[model samples]
Target: MTTTTEPTARPRTHKRVPAAPNRARKNPTRKRGPGSYAVIAAVTVFVLAFLSPFAIILVNSFKTGADYRANGSLSLPEQWNWSVIGDVWERVEFTQKLINSIQISLGVVLIAVVLALFNAYAIGIGRVRWRTAFLVFFLGVNVLPQEGLVYPIYYLFKEMGLYDGKLGYTILVGITYSAFGTYLLSSVFSSFPKELIEAASLDGAGRWTILWRIVLPMSWPTLSVMCVFFFVWSWNEFLYPLVLLISNDNQTVPLGLSVLQGQYSSDPTSMSAAALLGVIPMIVFFLIFQRSLTRGLTAGAVK
Candidate 1:
């Protein structure tokens, strides 16, 4: 029958093909190039630049009076003057001034945050008719230079019998500065979702509850940042405390540090020691909250 149908199609022969190996299994390590070296070099340079001043200060802090005077600002200390720190501690009363600064900074941060949060809530989430006007007024305060306002503020404090004491003077200064903080936080609050408030309200939560529970939790990043800013500002505030607060007994750290410099001008070693002591707390604070500061500063900028 026609040669048995072409030998039954040669039994339909099939070829076996091997499975492809996984691409991920081959050379999982990434290759480094000139770009990686460039990045490393750039990072090293930046780190050195940032640390140079600190190194200078640290080395100077440990130097003897003669060494500090003879050697340059960049020179290393020949002998460790460990006693310089104790000499500064007693002469400057660093601990007392530190306590005073800490109290004032903490108070200012607390008051500023509270006022700012509430003001921001009102302007941003609330349906108040004067929201825009209030926002503008607050913004105006920020534009006015603190230097220009110093004279007027000092005179006002002098007239109002609020210039000398610890609590009243510090509180008033913080209140005056609170306006700018309020404006900043208000901008953050404005960016919050309205649905959050509405949802809270619908769930039988009051305004205060919504603010404390919902708004404050979400606003932590902003609050943390503002706290750090206010703390640093109030801590380093020299001119205001110098001009307004007349009592050295109640002097803040900045003023006290200046007084320490005056009292120890002849002792260069002690001066550096005092300066290092003054800077330590601030350095600690910044180190702790620096990440939050960076995050909060850029968090809501996009929208």
Candidate 2:
């Protein structure tokens, strides 16, 4: 019995290791809190506040001059005269002016976007000498008041036989607007993944093919926003068009609106009607591309 007890087993030992670190779970679709709703409500109120004037103009446009003067701008129309819209259309040469605006705006947008994309690619994607200096020079050109350039541009274009018509106006506006577009698109191109371009090049894609197939498709949102910016700017531009286009046929909506004030300065209703009609196209255009505009502007923040 003593010998058996002496042979008792020794105690067993075990090694302990540290546990793995806890990983944080990610939430891609977290629910918004009450504060978010509050913010949305506040923004809605602010937007409504800002747009109230336009709303007033629209409402009063449908009313008689007396209705607005008597009941104030916010009041609904007591008597609707839809004919005022027609009257204004004729007076403003709505058809001609609208056509001019569309032609010039779309033309400027097209030219500017194309030029900006190419220039941006040259500066941002290409290995160019003094690219930074070129960019600075371009942006600096816009630093001075556009009004200051009116005289210089007027003389330059006049001598070059580029003034008076839609083509000339488009070219001028496109070139001027491209100053900003170049800066903007260059930044976008700079941000693009260099690896993609390298990979494409390795796959035997030419520069032209890469631009249309890859760059254009990928940067469509930003490009669309740029188009909108140019469109809005060209549409609202008064000074350049004024100086360049001497005749009524070549003028855009802003100038047409000015004519409205001059002719119907005494009649607020007709003026309002004309203004409302004048801006409808722009409003529609903005609404159509609102999503792309938002996405493009926020792209830098996103990635």
Best prediction by lDDT: 2
How high is each candidate's TM-score?
0.83, 0.81
Q: Which stretches of candidate 1 lie over 4 Å from their true place?
A: 1-21, 25-39, 262-266, 290-303
> How many clashes show up per model?
0, 0
Which stretch of 10 consecutive residues in model 1 shows the poorest summed lDDT?
A: 1-10
lDDT of 2: 0.85
> Candidate 2 lDDT, tens digit per residue, 119-173?
9988988858998898997799668687898999889887988878678779877
Off by over 4 Å in 2: 1-44, 263-265, 298-303
For candidate 1, give the lDDT of residue 219: 83
